[model samples]
Target: MATTTAPTTESLSDAVRRQSMAEAHTIQAMVDYRDAEMARTALIESSLRRKIERSAIALTIGEATGMSEARIQLRLSIADRVRDKTPQVWEAFVDGIIDFSRVRDISATIEKLHREESVARLENRVVGYAADHTGTELRQWLRRFVQRVEADLAVERADAARKDRHVAVAHGDDSMSWLNAYLPSHEAAAIEARLRKEARKPADPDDDRTVAQREADLLVGWCTDSDAATSAIDANIAVTVGADVLAGATPGFAESTDGCWAVPAPWLADVVATGGTFWHRIVVDPVSDDVLAHEYVGRFAPDTLAVALQFLHGVCQAPGCMVPAERCDLDHRIPHPAGPTTGDNMGPLCRRHHNLKGHGLLHWSTSPPAELIVIELYPPTPAVEMEYVAA
Candidate 1:
C-alpha cells in the first residue's frame, strides 16, 4: 500500500524560506511595476495626455495579475505608501516577519493621519508591534494611537462628518430588510454598548432568543415604541480630558476610555457642568499615569478604588484587548487574601482574560506602569502675516 508521509524537517525549513522569499519578491515586483507604469505615463506630457481619473495603467496591471483594477490600485497604493512613509514597515515585510496583508492595513491607517511627523512616529511604533500582534490587536492599537495623536484634528473632522449622518433601508428577499445607520462613532458605540449590556441581563428561562436576537428586539422596540425597554436610555461610558482645557486655559482633546472615539474638550466640560449624572471628574497624572484626584455622587458612584483602576488603565490589561476598563473585572494582581486590593495591586481584565489569569495560563508585568508611552506632539505654529511697508 502506498502511504503519504509529512515532509522532512530540512525540506519543510527550505519550503518556508522559499515561501517568505517569494512573498518579499512579489511585493517588490508590484512596487517596481507601479513605478514603471507611472514613469511611462509621465513621459506622455502632450495635450492629449490622459487624466489621472483614467485608470488605464491600473487596468493593464489588473489584466496581467488577474486582479480587479480597484484591487491592483489598492495593492500598488499600499506598496508605494508603506515604502514612502515607513521604510521599517517595508523592511519588516521584506524580512517576512509580517506580510502584505498587515502592510495594507497599516498603510490604510497611516493615510488617515495628515501630519508627516505623526505618521513617522506611529510608523516607528507599529513596525515592531505588528511583528508580534494579530491583525485585530494591531487594529485596536492603531485606533487608540491615531485617536490620541490627532485628538484636536479628530474633533474637527468629527464635527464635519456629523453633517452627513444618515440611515438607510434596503429591501431583501422573504420580506426581510437591512437597516443601517451612519452615525458619529461615540453615539454608535454608546447605542451598541447599551444594547449589548441590556441583552446580557438575566432573562426568562423559557426565552429562546439568543443575545443578538435579544439586542435586535430591544433596539426595534426602543425605536418603534417610546415606552419599550426604558429603564435607562443613557449608556455609561468614560471620557478623560484635562481641567485646564475644560476651563479654556489650554487646548486639549477628550479621549474615550473605550478608545472608540475622541471629541473636542468642550463636550466633556459641557456634560460635567450641565450636571450629566454619569460624568465624573478624575484628575490624572499624564507623566506617571496616576489618578491623583476624583469626584462622584449617588448613581454616578462606583467603588472609589474601582474608579481609580478604570481611569488608570482605560482598557483591559490583557495585551491588545480593547474591552473598556470600566466594563472589565477589577482583578487583583497578586490574588485576593494575599494581595491587598490597592490601585497598585489591582487592574482590569475582561472575563476571558480573568479566567486565563485565574488558571495561571497568563502573566502580567508591572515594570512600566501606566498607559503613558509618551508621544510628544508638536503644535502647528501660528502663521504670521507680513505688513506691506511703502518701499
Candidate 2:
C-alpha cells in the first residue's frame, strides 16, 4: 500500500497567503486595464456622455475578465480609492496580508466621511483592524466608527430614514405572506426585547411550541386585537450612551447593553423625555464613543471580574468563531494550579473550543499584560495577534 502524508497546518497557511497574493495581482491587473480603457477612449469619447463611455469600457472589461460590468465598476471604485488614499492598506493588499474584501469594505466606508482629517484617520487606523477581523465584523466596526466621528451625519441619516418607516407585506411562494416593518432602532429594539421577554414566560403545560413560535404567536395575537397598542407586554430598555451625547455633543451613539444596536446621540432625549436615569458600570473596558479601537488595550481590570470578562471578550477566543462571550465558558488559557483564575489567565472560550483545549488540541499564548492573548490552532495566527477591546 502507498502511504500519503496529510498537508500540515503551516502549508495550509502558506497556501492562503499564496492565494491572496494571486488575487491581489489579479485586482491590480483589472485596475490597470480600466485605466488603459479610460485613456484610450478619452479623446474619441469626449463627445459622448460619461456614463455611456464608462459602460462600454465596463462591458469590454467584463467580457475579458469574466466579471459583470456592475461588479467590475465597484471593484474599480474601491481600487481607485485605496490607491489614492490609504497606502498602508494598499501595501497590505499587495503583500497578501489583506485582500480585495478588506480594500472594498474600507474604501466603501471611507466614502461616507466628508472630512479630510477623518478620512485620513480611518485610512491610518483601519488596516490593522481589517486585517484581523472578518468582513461582517469590519463593517460593524466601521459603522460604529462612522457614528463616533460623524455623529451628526449618523443622527441626521437616522432621522431622515425614520420618516420613511412603513410596513409592507410580500406574498410568498406558499399561501402565506411576510410582514416587514421599518422602524427606528430603539423602537425595534423594544419590540424585539418585549417579544423575547414574553416568550420566556410560562405557557400552558401541554404547549410544545418553541420560544420563537411563541413570539410569532404573541405578535399575531397582539396585532389581531382591537387595542393592540395597549397590549400587556412590557419591555425594559438597557441602554448606554456617552456623557457627551447626553450633553448635546455629538461624540458617540447610544447603544443597547449587549452591543446589538445603536441609535443616534440626540435620540437620548426621546429615550429619557419623561425622565429616566443612567448609571456607569466599570466593565474595566469602558469605551469612549469617540476614541479609536486600539487605544483601549485590555490591562487586567473590574465589573466584579465576571461581568468584566463578558464585556472584555465579546466573542469566543477560538480562531474565527462567532459565538458571543456571554454564551462561552470562562476558560483559563493556562491550566489551573499553573495559571491563576484571575482575568490575566482567563478569557471566554465556547464549549466546543474549551473541550478542544481539554484534549490538548487547542492552545492560547498570552503576551504582556497589555497585549493580546493569541490562540495557536489550525492555520496558526501570529503570536503578536493580541485581541482588542475598544469599548
Candidate 3:
C-alpha cells in the first residue's frame, strides 16, 4: 500500500490476453442467449394458426427490437434451421468458438444444400473453418466448396433463383429513393461495372456532382431516357480474367475492378458466347498481381490510366469514404496543371470530398515511398481538426 509497483511486462501481456478471452466468452454467451430467444419466438410463431398471425409475430418482434420485420424473420428462420438441421453449428456457437455471424453463414450455407445428408456434410466441413476465418472468408470458401460438391445441382438452383429476380423502389426521407434489385450475380455485376465505368468519364470542370450522384443520374437516365441509355449501353465494361481461364485452358472466376462479385467460369463463357462485348485487356504480372500492359480489344479506347488507378485503389481515396473508385473522379493530389498527371500524384475522390478539398475545407498531400495520402480535415463553425492516412 505504501509503494505500488508498475505491472511487469509479462504480467501485463497475460492480463491483456485473459481480458480478450473473457470478452470473447461474453460475446459467445450473448449469442447463445439470442439463439434461445429466437428459438422461443420461432416456436410461438409456428403455433399460430394463420399466416397473418405468423407475420404479426415478426412485426411485433421488429417493433420491440427496433429491427425491420425482414431482419426479425431472418433471425427466426436461422434459429429454426439450427434447431432442426444443424445442431452441430449451434453447439459450436454455444462452446464460444464461433459467433452468431458465423452461425448465420453456416445456417445459410446448409439451407442451400437442399438435402439432409449434404447439409450434414457441409456443416461438418465448415464449422471448424468458421472458427478460424472471418465471416467474409467463410462465405467465399462456402460458395466455392458448394459448387465443387454439387456441380450438377448448381445450374438448376441458379436458374430457379433467377426466376425470383425483380426490381423495387423504396422512398426515403429528403425526397430520396432507394432502388433495389434481386438479380443474378453475373448480370448484376455486369450492370454495376458498366455504371461505374460510365460514371468515371470526365465531366465539365464546373460540374459539382459527386461520383455517386453521377452514377444515380446515369442509372435514371439509362432507365427512363432512351438516348442516354443507348449511349451508356454502348460503352464497355472491363472484366478481369486469367488468360488461361479466358482461353478455357483453366477454370476460374471472372472479376471486375471493384471485386464486389465474381462470375463463374461457365457463366462467363456463356456471356462471351452470347454476344458479350470485349473491351480492353489489361495484363498483369501473375506473381505480383500488378498491371504490366494494356491492349485494346475493341474499337473504343478505354481509359487505361483510369482503369489502372481504379484497380490499385478500388475505392475513393478520401479517408473514411467507400465510394468505388470506378465511380469516382481521378484527381491530382496537386492540381492537375500544377502537378503532372502521373500515378504518383493521382487519386480517386468522390464528388463531395473533391468539392470539399477544392473549397479549402479539407487539405491533403501525398507522401513518397509509401505513396500514402495524409489528409487534414477542418470542419466549419466550431472548428474541429481530424487527420487520416489513406494508402
Candidate 4:
C-alpha cells in the first residue's frame, strides 16, 4: 500500500485561503451571469414591445425563472441601476471586490438620490468604501453621506417617504411569520425601543416566555387588549445626536442605541418639537462618548446602571445570538442571590439562553471586574467556547 502524507499547517491554511478566493470568484461570476441575463431579457422585452403593443417583461422573466414578479422587478431594477448609473460598482463587483448584496445596496442607495448627478457623485465616493465595509456599514455610511450631500432636501424627502409608510405581514416556514412596518425612522425606532423596554417587565416570577415571545405578545396585546394599549409610551431610548444638530444649528443624523438605524436631524427635530414632553436628554462627553448626565422629563425613571450595562453589551452574551441587550433579561453569571446585582456580575441574556444557562444546558464563565464572557454549549461538542469582549 502507498503511504499518504498528512497536510502540514501551512498547507491547510493555504487551502482555506484558496477556497475563500475561489468562493469570491464564484460570486463574481454569478453577478456577471445575472447582469447578462437581465440585459438579454431587457433587449427581448424591448423588441417584443416594438413588435406587439404591450409586453410584461418582468412577468415573462419571472415565469421563465420561477421567480415572483416582484423579485424579478427588484432584480431588474438593481441591474439597471448598476449598469446605467454606477457602472464602476458593477465593475468592482465583477472584480470580486464586493459581493452581490453590497452591489444591490449600492444600487438602491444610488437610486434613492433621485438626481442622476447626485447618484453619480455618491457612487464615485462609495465604490472604494464598499470594498472595506460590510453591507450594513455601507448603508449607514450612505445615510450620513446623503445628509451631507442633500441637507436641504432631507425634510421634504422624509415627508414624501412617510406617505409610503405601511405595515406588512408575511408567512414563513415552521409556523413562524414576519411582521414588518415601514414607517418614519424616528417613530419606528421609538416603537422598537418601547417594545424592548416593555418586554423586560414580567408580571410574575414564573413567566417563562422568552423576551422575543414577550415582545410579540406585547404587540398583539397592545393591538387587541385595550388595557395594554392604554398605557403611555414611557420608554427611554438612547439616541446620540450631535449637540449642534439637536440645537438646530446644523444638519446631521441621530443614531439609535445599537447603531443599526439613523434618522435625519430635521425629521428628528419635528419629532422633538411635537413630543418634547416625552423626551429625556442624555449629555455625553464629546471626545470620549461617555454619558455625563441623564435628564428625565416624564414620570418614568430608568435604572442608570441597567442602561449602562445594556449600552456596554449591545447584544445578548449568548454565543451566536444577536438579540439586542435592551430586549434581554439581565442575567447574573453567578446565581442572583449569591452573585451581587452589580455591573461586574450582570450580563444580558435573552430568555431562551437564560433558561439554557439556568437548566445547565449551556455554561458560561466570566472574568470579573473587566467582565470578559466565554460561553460554551454542553456535551463538549467540538469543544468550542465563544468569547465576548466587553465594550
Best prediction by lDDT: 2
Better candidate number, 3 or 4, judged by lDDT: 4
lDDT per model vs. reference: 0.67, 0.71, 0.65, 0.67
Each candidate structure's TM-score, on Cα atoms with residue i matched to residue i, is 0.63, 0.64, 0.49, 0.53
Candidate 1: Cα lDDT at 202: 90
Query: Quick one: ranking by TM-score, best first?
Result: 2, 1, 4, 3
- Local lDDT at 174 for model 1: 100
**Model 3, range 119-183, lDDT digits (tens) per residue?**
87887788789877767888887876565456447656766777899999999999998999998
Q: Write out the backbone clash pairs for model 4.
A: none
Regions more than 4 Å wrong, model 3 = 1-80, 83-87, 170-176, 226-270, 273-391
Ranking by lDDT: 2, 1, 4, 3
C-alpha RMSD for every candidate: 18.4, 19.6, 19.0, 18.2
Error of 2 at 114 (Å): 0.4
lDDT of 2 by residue, 148-250 (tens): 7888787777888889999999999879889999987877876787788788889889999999888887788778864323344555565666655655644
Question: How many clashing residue pairs, candidate 2?
Answer: 1
Clashes of 4: 0
Worst 10 residues of 4 by lDDT: 382-391
- How well does model 3 score by local distance difference test? 0.65
* lDDT digits (tens) for residues 1-391 of candidate 1: 9999888987875675467567778767766877787677777766356456235777877787788988878887788888888888888778776767777789988888999989989977997898778788788788667766776676677678878999999999999899999976555755776788788889999999999999888988888885546665444666665555555665555666754565666655434433223444455555464676554311233467678889988988876888999899876655533444356666788998878766665554433445332111122123312211111
